[model samples]
Every structure is written in structure tokens, then in C-alpha cells.
Target: MPNPKITTLIITYNEMDYIQKCIDSIDFTDEIIVVDSYSTDGTYEYLLHHPKVKVIQNPFENFTSQKSFALKQAKNDWVLFLDADEVVPEKLKLEIKSTIENTDCAAFWFYRKFMFQNKPLNYSGWQTDKNYRLFRKSKAKFSDKKIVHETLVVDGKSGILNEKLIHYCYKNYEDYKSKMLKYGRLKAKEDFYKENYFNYLVYILKPAWKFFNHYILRLGILDGKKGLIICYLNALGVLERYKELKRLEKKNELAYHLVMP
Candidate 1:
């Protein structure tokens, strides 16, 4: 049988627990490129021993820069980007192998099955979460956004894949909160730099509205306690982002006055 003509690219930062499983699932790929962020954990050591993996140590920049760097490193014309915390299911792996062999589409989006604390989230505004993961190397690249969430800038046609990729988001509230704080700070800094000021209404009302939309309108309440937790966290994330933006603006204003005066 002929080997699948695609490369798998994964960007990592201390993702030791999930890296091996993610790698094992994509055994069909012709090449595997792992661009790491100088992980102090055993992730680097394990990748070094893996015969199939090409490991490159790049210091932490942002998502877009790191992913764009990884895209350039891929040997195959076709590429699949996988997060270290996400696992490609067996059926999805087979589907990817077959789809790439047959289809001419430049990219394929797959449904991500989100799991929170070992339970699959059937509701809670997470279902039908599709992301473009498979694409032609030359046709797409990561946007130059220095932030937590970076979108793919694709020039070619894109389609959807049938199967799903499992995403293990957060084990508990603490994990969610930690990410919220970090991402909020980064997002706030980005907004502040762009001169996007935070309004009183936006800061307060937006979070409340988001909670209502996610938990009530989206039927997140049907999922029980987990749903409520997800909604609360989502709202908290919004609030933190606004608060961080205000703090950043204040700091910048103080620095400017000090330097000028």
C-alpha cells in the first residue's frame, strides 16, 4: 500500500501528558514535525527519542508565529495541524487518510468533540465546534496575530471532514481559570495596543449577556452542573479580559506621562 501523502504538525509547550497519545494517533502521516517552546518537562526528551518525529526548539512567541514557523518546516505539500491536548480519533484518522488520497480540496474542517473533566460535552455551546485542521501547506498559513487564538489564512478551497477530533479542554475549574487569566491578559494587551477602549456598558453588560446566551439561549442549562460551570467560566473570561484591558490602559497612560514630563 502507498503511504499517505501528508505531514502532521504539532506545536507544544510542556504538553508531556498528551503528546505521546497525539503522536500515536497520526501514525499514517509521512512526516511529523513538532515545534516546541523550550518545554522544561519531559516532552522534549520523549520527542527526541521518537524516531519519526522532527523536533525543533523555538522559544515561546505567540500562536500564529509558532504555527507559521511549523508550517514552513513541514516536508509534505499537505499538512494537518493538531493541538497537543487534542486527540485524533481512530475513525477520524482513517477518514483523513482516505480524504487526502481522494479529495482535491485545499483544506478540511473537522468537528471537535470537546471533553471537560473526562466527560464529553454534548451541549454547553461547545457542540458543532468545527476547525480547519487539514490543508495544503502552500495554500494556508497562520495569521500574524500575537495572541492566544490565531486564525488560519487560507487562499484555497476548504471543505468539511466527516469524523471528529477529541479536545480535552479543562480538567477542572482551576485549569479553566488559569487559562482565562493568562489569555485575558494577552487579549487585553492586544486590545490596548490597538487603542480599543473598554466601555462601562461593554465591560459589565457583555459578560452578563454572554452568560445568558450561552447558558439559557444555547440550552447549556440542559447539560446540568457542567453546563453551568462552562457558562460561568465563559462569562468570567469576558470580565477578566475587560478588566485587564482597563489595567493595561492605565499603565500605558502612566508610562506615557512619566516619559513625556
Candidate 2:
């Protein structure tokens, strides 16, 4: 039987460090469609010469929208969505090729193994990570509500894949902090726009709960220093997000009063 053709879709921003490796990992695929956000870090320039890769620039508004646009650009029935910081290992590649040729379901979910600070983490909420990234083009659509965490809604039956998708999540504290700040602000804006009420008590208690949940309840302590840092930083991110949300609310309120009352 002939190998089934698949279009790999990727949404990227300033991802120069991981873009090349991410594209190279799926070299066996038929076509790669990348929707970049006018990367100032030379990510777009580096991918310009690749023959099999088609790249386009769109101002990134949110994850769901950017991904939806990329999905439309896909030229094949079977499509795979990958992040610039992720790679499909050889084993997973073989499985993907074989599965696509004989897929019984419309979509497949694969477990993701995350690498943080150059170390692969086995616990602390990373072990349970899974996402539906491979699907029939017509069967998948990202949820309409764009937020910090957007999920894909599959129209038909979904199956699980045996192999794991390797994710290079963060190389160090600086990488983690950059994403933390960016995502924090985005999430705060989403929450504010959604009219989610903010409670002072909840704000004070939430981060503490998050730290405990990750560090102790989730066995983050077992992973050593990296785990502790990860858990703590995540907690900090939650706190910072709420703080940003509060700031936005205050600024809007002041503007309204100054203009009218």
C-alpha cells in the first residue's frame, strides 16, 4: 500500500531556537504548513529556504485563531498539528505513518512527555499530558472561545496513540519566565473579558493552593530542584495573572470616572 499523505500544521512566533529541529523531525511528511506571527527573532527567515515547507505570516491574536487559520491552509485530508518546540521521535513517526494508513477513527490523542531545563520530567502534572493533535482535516476544529488554554473539538471518534510526543517546553528559568509573563497577561485579559468576577480572598489563596498542589500533592518534590522551581514558578504565574487582571480593571474604572463622573 502507498503511504498516506499528511499535511503538518504549525503556528509559530519567535521560535528560532526550536523551529528548525521541529521541522526536521517531520521530514518524512508530505507537506508542512507554518503560520508565523512575523517573528523578529529570525525564525521566519531561517525557514524561507525549505522546499517542502510553506510559510505565511499572520498577526497572532490568540492560539485558537492562529491554529484555525493554519488548519485551513492544510492541503491534505490527514493533518497533524505540532508546536515549534515539539518533535516527533523516530518511533512515533513510524507509528504515525502506519496509523494514518489504517486509521479507524477521525482523530488520535497522544501523550506528551515534557522536557524542562534540559531534563525530562516524569511527574508533577507532566505525566498526564495528552492532546488530540492528529486528525482528519474536516473532523477537527479549535474551540471558538479563545483563552489561555484552548482545546480542539473533534467531530468523530477519537483514539489514543501508543507513542509519546516529545515537548521541549522550557530550557531554563528565563524561558519559563518569558512564557509565564506572556501567557499570564493573555489569560488575565481573557478572564476580564469573560466577566469572571475577581475575589480578593481567592486571589490570596489560589497561588498557595497551586504551590501545594504541585509541590506536595502532585509529588513535585520527588523530581528535585527542577520540580520545585517548576511548581513555584507556576504558582507565581497564577498570582501574576490575577494581578494583571486587577490592574486592567482599575485602569478601565479610572478612565470611565475621569471621562464621565
Candidate 3:
């Protein structure tokens, strides 16, 4: 058979729960490259047994660095980046295949359909989410931001795929809180170094606005309990960011004075 035109790339870190489904969805690709962050879980073992997959073990660093490493390791000219908790729907798989074979666009953004507790969340401000996952390897690279929510920067023309990629973002409340705390800390560090500050008005207004925007304006209410939960958690994430930022600022100031004095 002729060589496959696309390479599927994924990065994993203790993603045992979703790794199997993620791998199964992209079996159509010519090549699959998984760069794992030394998962203590059985993720590495599972990938090793998969015949179509090539696994690379690297130490955990930042999202962009890990994804860029995977991008470089891809053998095919076209690359599709998928998270371990995300799967390409069968319809999306066919759409992507057709796009790759027929179109000359360098990149295509896939609409993501997020699920919470196995429920399809039609609102919660998540319906508008789109990601540039399918791209020509030569035309794009991930930004070297030291954060978990980094994005790919593509150099050529890009288009959108109508089909949705299923994204299982959070399984439960505890999982949500755990990620929020970790992400809040990283965001706080970035803001503190950039001399960003939060005032009383912003501290109160930001979270409120976030809830209003996601739940009310974005029609998240239609999604029922899942929408409310997501909106509440999103606001909490914003609040935690401000709290962590202030804490980091105070710590940095104390360290600076002690070292100079």
C-alpha cells in the first residue's frame, strides 16, 4: 500500500484512563508518535505493546516543549495532535482523511465537543472551542511557552473542519480542582514576573463576569448541571489565578529584599 499521508502525535503523562481509546481512534493514520513524560502509570507499557505506535520517553517539562519534541519526531509531512483524553470521532476521522487528500490548506482547526461525566456539553462556553491540530509539519511549530495551555503557531493558510473531536476534559470535581490548583500556580508565576497586578475591583468582577459570560451570555444554562458546574469551576480558576499571583508577588518581594540587604 502507498505510504499514509498523516502522522498522529500525542503527549501523555499518567494518562492510562484515556490512552487506549485515544490510540484506537487514530489507527487510520500512517504513523502515530507518542511522547510520554515518564509516566509511572501503565501508559508506557500499553504503548509498547501497540504495534502501530512509536513511543518516546522524556522527562516532564512544559506542554509546548513536549509537543514540539513530538512534532519533530513525526515522520510524515502532515501532523495531527491529539490529547490523551481526546478522541477523533469516526466522522471527524473521515473528514480529516478527505481534507488531507483533497485540500492544499496547510492547517485545519477541528471543533471540539467537550463531555463531562459522559454527557455532551452543548454549552458552558466550551462549544466554541477550536484547535489547530491538523497541520503541515513544515509550516507550523508550537510556541515555547512554559505553560500547560500552549498553542501551535502555524505559518500557512488554515481552514476549519466541521466535524467535532470528542474531548473528555474532567471526570469529576476533584480532578477539576487538582488541575485548577496546578494551572493557577503556573499562571501566577507568569503574571508575577510580568509585573501584573490585581485590584479589588478586578478580583470581584473578573470571576463574576466569567460566570455571566459562560453561563448566561454563552447559553451554558441549556447544558443543565454540567454547564453550571463548568461555569462555576471556570470562575474558580480565575479566582485562584489572582490569589496565586498575589502570593507569588509577596514572596518574590521578600526574597529580593533579603538578598539585596
Mind giving the per-residue lDDT tens digits that candidate 2 earns over 100-218?
88877999999998888558887776778898889998888888776656788888899999999999987778878778877878888888888876779878998899899988888
User: Superposing all C-alpha atoms, what RMSD in Å does each candidate have to the true structure?
Assistant: 1.8, 1.5, 1.9
The 10 consecutive residues of candidate 1 with the worst lDDT sum are: 141-150
RMSD of 2: 1.5
Clash count of each predicted structure:
0, 0, 0
Where model 2 places Cα greater than 4 Å from the true spot, the runs are 258-261
TM-score for candidate 3: 0.92
lDDT of 3 at 227: 84
TM-score of 2: 0.95
63-155, model 3: which lDDT tens digit per residue? 777888888898889999999999988999889887787777889998998988787889889878998889999999877654657777888
The TM-score values for the models, in the order shown, are: 0.93, 0.95, 0.92
TM-score computed on alpha carbons, candidate 1: 0.93
For TM-score, candidate 1 versus 2, the one ahead is 2
